[model samples]
Target chain A: MKEGKISLEEVKHIAKLARLRLSENEEELMTHQLNNILLYMEKLNELDTSNIEPMHHAVEQVNVMRDDKLKPSLSSEKALSNAPQQNGVFFVVPKVL
Target chain B: MTEEITQWSIIETRRRLAKKEINAIELVETYLKRINSLNPSLNAFITVCEELALKEARYYVDHPDKLVEKPLGGVPIAIKDCLCTEGIRTTCGSKILESFVPPYNATVVEKLLQAGAIIIGKTNMDEFAMGSSTEHSYFGPARNPWDTSRVPGGSSGGSAVAVAACLCPGAIGTDTGGSIRQPAAFCGIVGMKPTYGRVSRYGLIAFASSLDQAGPMARNVQDTALLLQVISGYDPKDTTSILKEVPPYCEEMKKPVRNLRLGIPKEYFAKGIDSSIEEAIRQALRVYENLGARIVDISLPHTEYGVAAYYIIAPAEASSNLARYDGVKYGFRAEIPSPDLIHMYLETRSRGFGSEVKRRIMLGTYALSSGYYDAYYHKASQVRNLIRKDFEEAFLTCDAIIAPVTPVAPFLIGEKLDDPLSMYLSDVYTLPASLAGIPGVSVPCGFSPEGLPIGMQILGNYFQEDLLLRLAYIFEQETGLSPKYPSI
Candidate 1:
């Protein structure tokens, strides 16, 4: 783990965690590009942020709450309209276990 | 006459429609004709809804009673493909969603339709609004109408080019780290990013949630103001939407620029700016000085860290937001032998997302992964806070800030394609304002010696869009620079 350098093995690990299957060529390209960006982003480490609070939202707003009354949502048919693979009213997926 | 009609501002188009001098069908046909001829060369639009737009136009024409006082009566506007349009394919410029048609319209789209604006088409964009240049789009890069070889800035490049080439009077664009304003500058038009949460993001495809904002891109400031007025207001659908009352932006455009204290951040002018663009911006400042506005020197000391912070924060958010596109859900699914759910997810994502998108997702995953979270994402967020505070202190002595939208003018399309870091640097000037969650408008100030257009960015504090519009409108009127459309 050289400072700010992303190796091919690490790129593969990150891609798997991100649910992306990278080919060998893509893994190499991603390794090179991500390492370049991460090295450049090391500029953030130069800033002294000892007392600073991390900003989650650009604008400050309290959590918005609404009544728990039932509301209309997309019908099952409409919700399934864009599904890649569906069966009857259910979205189909690969076997899990 | 057709050229004149296509080039008319939204206000003028509305006036003519109200006066019955021109009907909606005639306007739609004229734009359709222009699009038919020019879109091939410009590659600005992904889909042209000729039939749907004509139908909407004819309905307005036949039922003259319906046109009484609708603000955007019969005007055609292009939408960035990233927004959901019911039954219209919203590709977000990725293969994953190539066949995906949204089930509903974005809040902004609904608002535009209610104002009687007809949908012209869905414009092209950088895939998932990830890149700064439209070249990253799957449909192909949208050529700059100004010079076919040069690039129109992106991920809102198509929207800007559509408006620039007169294919549409105005277009909707989403800006996350300069997507809207940068393209607007490159295309020589008016583009604005309203304050964060000023417009609802309920149905806009997520890019970087905290940084993304939908805004109006038009030929002039007045039309931009009108479009902004229509799409803006509190929407209960977006939880982050502020409850503040929407101000009369178009009306505010009438206010004088007297006594306005404009800030010229010393850091923006430091280095890396093209000499010609600096001259144009300086001349624009002189025009403001002559118009009775005072120029104040201010320091946004943390400006240099804006790009670095933005890259981390945006991709971190994008990685989380984009995790929803598994094979079982909507969007693209790879045709592979999936032995298990994990394999399915991996195959779908790899085949679905483009290279830049994959790059960002990987960067984000690593940044948020264990042992690296505190050093990268958390540090970037703290830098973001400092960046915001810089703007807060600067605005105390200045009503708005004026700066170049980009360090250089619109570059050759493939120049920065391979060099991702350089492409990221192109957004240096505009990213700070996005990080601060302020409203910023890019207005055409002058043209470079090579004939490419340059734009000056006007930034105002949060919820101060009215003031930004007022200043931009005054500048547009005084310089009369925006009328020179690209000779497409």
Candidate 2:
């Protein structure tokens, strides 16, 4: 693994991006886990990729776009039928404010 | 006779359906009964749509003359709950959307229906396809049929288990990382993840939008090929859907890989691999050699970066994709008296998502959030590119890569539940294919000393599913390892 040290705060930062509110216990757990993972990845740092171009998709397809067209869509009433609560034409929920 | 019927392949089933030896209703009912009996132990299905399945079966029976003998006509298949099915619930194995039903069917579902396939039910999965072991499902973890105490690999665990247990002849599973292949390996079934963009994802719930792809899980390579033929094609609704013509997947199965070159990546064989798995793969390679194929040693030096890149890229996309689950839209709504919209968002998210999913979403959010995007998310994507490039370089000298799908055989239930890293290790060999958007197939190579299944992965260049399935088919025939069923 090529990478070095990762901070506890960095783990917290990544956790927040993940939308997880971790307990202190989890933070401690992830700090150890992520560090070990980075250590494993450090092996890649030894590889010489300076001459190689990065690969994306295996195939050489580019901009395989479809023509814009209108098609039938589900009615709002049908779309929101399973909503726990709904307003007319839209699913409803508790007011944010 | 009915038991024999349950064991037939998709092609055999289609032939029987054509000859009128078995009508659609009997076919559907056989599976419904099997599912009822075996699912208790496997926990493969979340909802059994018996009424709808029978209704569709009745239609097929009543109009047998009009049936065109479509590729998968009257074949019973299980679906991962993450794929939307019109008029049926699409909970994605999350309690947050327990009551959520979609008015539209996913593109793959629509394609299956058009081909006259009968859907048995929705199978269990990781909540929002987050975890590697279906343990994250609010419903329950799907068990390995070989040993009821063991786990079926997840996100697509239920799909694989259903096919393995003969509850359904085939099923559809989505793989973002190793969701499809890992579970298939664990359950001793055949699972294929097509090249990214080969299958349309219009209505499949997003995990990592860029990485998520739907594929087939079945008892054999031929059945997987048939399912792939029916469900694959370009869809205008999906902007990312490839417009390139899809090869006849079924016909590809009949093609032989005589004189083909197989590559075994050195990185894949590193110290982390189980010695037993390595031996099985070595044995399989000798079989390939006897079949007129030559083995080449190759190095994918960047293989080590796959999991790290995947964790970062997957979460970044997952955080954005799951944002739609807020109380404002059609998913789960929590009643919380909050001071502002932000508070409401937090309350709904906090209450709606599972712990693992929340953790990922937060990680993703932080990765993409201000100030850290370049350091974490962007850097990860660059590494993803490097990982993908590694495959390109290896493919330059070899036709396909053969390696162990997982290091170890199926572990007992709750074995890795507390350790997320251990669970993620199950996907190590399977993730590179997804990261590179290449086609990969997992075939049952041998059983562990404990009698649990072990699978070897065959990966091919993009759009080369023909080569992928052919290799698997050849091995299936040579080993004569086909037709092993789980004991009740």
Candidate 3:
């Protein structure tokens, strides 16, 4: 949690968690750029915000619920229209096990 | 006839269509011809729905009775590619969704169709609305119509240029930080970002969920207001949508800005702003003063922390929202010959997303990671509240706040491409309003000496879009600035 320079190893680890496979050049560039951004963002620590609550939503709208009703939705054909690889009803992906 | 049709506003086009001055098909053809002639150089539209637009316009032409009932009947409007259009490809300016077509229209798109506006095409934008410049687009950057060498500011660059260059009467653009306003300023058109919940975000490919709001961009304030009326309302589908009654925004323009208290945030005029842009905004303040509106100097104390906080909050949300694009259900999937599921996810994402998207995802993941959550994300959110409080307090003193849209003028196409931080800084002034969920409009105020247009942003309290439009309309009428067309 220290506000210091980010290492290439850290960038690679973060990218891995984000499910991104960055190249050697990207890893180096991301390390430098993220560190610069984080350093700039460190300015936020300057303000004393112990009393102020963190805002999750810009507007104060809570529990915006709609009536539960079964309505027509996209058909199987339309749902899988944009799938990279699909077999009419199911999306094809790499073997999990 | 084509020239006249291309220059008409939404209202003017509707009036002409109703009076038989121009048929719907003729109007559609006028814009289609212009798009074909200019889109090659400007790169404004990724997919021009010529046949679809014609088909819709012809329907309106044949059924004049139906055209009369619709507010935006026979009007040709372009949409930013991020907004989903049923059966039309909505790329969000990335190769990841290049071939993906939406099965259902976005809430705004559905509203536009109901209002009789023809969807001309899906315009270009930054890849997932991430970059300030459209250079991050999987498609090439949309060039500034003013100077082909310069960029029409993005990620709604294509939508802005389409309106600026007369490719479309008006276009819909979403603003997370300054995607709509900055681009509209750079292109010398009117763009607005309604209060966050004012417009539904159902089919808008989420960049930053809380910060994103879809609004209208047009050649003038009146047209912008008209288009906003057509698309603004409650949608039960989008939970964040406000259930407020949509006001007659165009009618509200008739009210004068005689005694309106306008606040000029002093921090925005500080250093880093180009001299010419500063001069133009100051001159605009003077014009408001002369028009009987009092301009008070105020300070948004937390203004400096806007960009820093926004970068944290927006990315964190984006990291979560974009996680859905893991090459499982839809979009681009890597053709890897391996039984390992994790490798496919990595390769698919790495190859699909652009550098900016990847950078944000990494930054977000780092911020939201186990130990760093309280440090980065939590701290940033607390600061975000402080920034919003600054606006709320400022509103108690003034009805609206006035400032420059962007600190600097539109730079060359590749000027800030390499420096990501510098590019992020461009949204410094506009980000505060977005963070506060306030409605802000960028009115074409004046042009820089380089002839690139400069815009002044007028911001109002949440759901005060009518006031923002009224103020911008007065400025537009007073200046009587003729629309400058880019000679392709």
- Each model's fnat? 0.94, 0.37, 0.91
DockQ of each: 0.85, 0.37, 0.85
Instruction: State each model's CA lDDT, in order.
Output: 0.92, 0.83, 0.91
- Cα lDDT tens digits, model 2, B1-488, are 76788888877888889999989998898888888888887889999999999998998888885454666777888899999999898889998888888888999999999888888899999999988888899998988888889888888999988888888889999999989998998898899999999999999999898889999999988889888988898998787778778888777777877789999998888987778788889999999999899899999876777777787778888888987876666777666654455555666677778877876775677668788676667666677777787788999999999998887787788888777767776777988888888889989998878888889999989888889989999899999876588886
* Per-residue lDDT of model 3, residues A4-84, tens digit only: 567888887898889998889988888888989998998998999999999888888888887788999999999988888
Q: What is candidate 3's lDDT per residue for B364-389, written digit by digit as tens?
A: 99999998999999999999999999
lDDT of 1 by residue, B133-220 (tens): 8998989999999999999999999999999999999999999999999999999999999999999998999989999999999999
Q: What is the TM-score of chain A in candidate 2?
A: 0.76
Off by more than 4 A, model 3: A1-4
Could you tell me which residue pairs clash in candidate 3?
A: none
The better-scoring model by lDDT among 1 and 2 is 1
Candidate 2: RMSD to truth: 3.0
Better by TM-score, candidate 2 or 1: 1
What TM-score does the first chain of candidate 1 have?
Answer: 0.89
Relative to the unseen true structure, what is the C-alpha lDDT of residue B375 in candidate 3, on a scale of 0 to 100? Answer: 91
Top candidate (lDDT) = 1
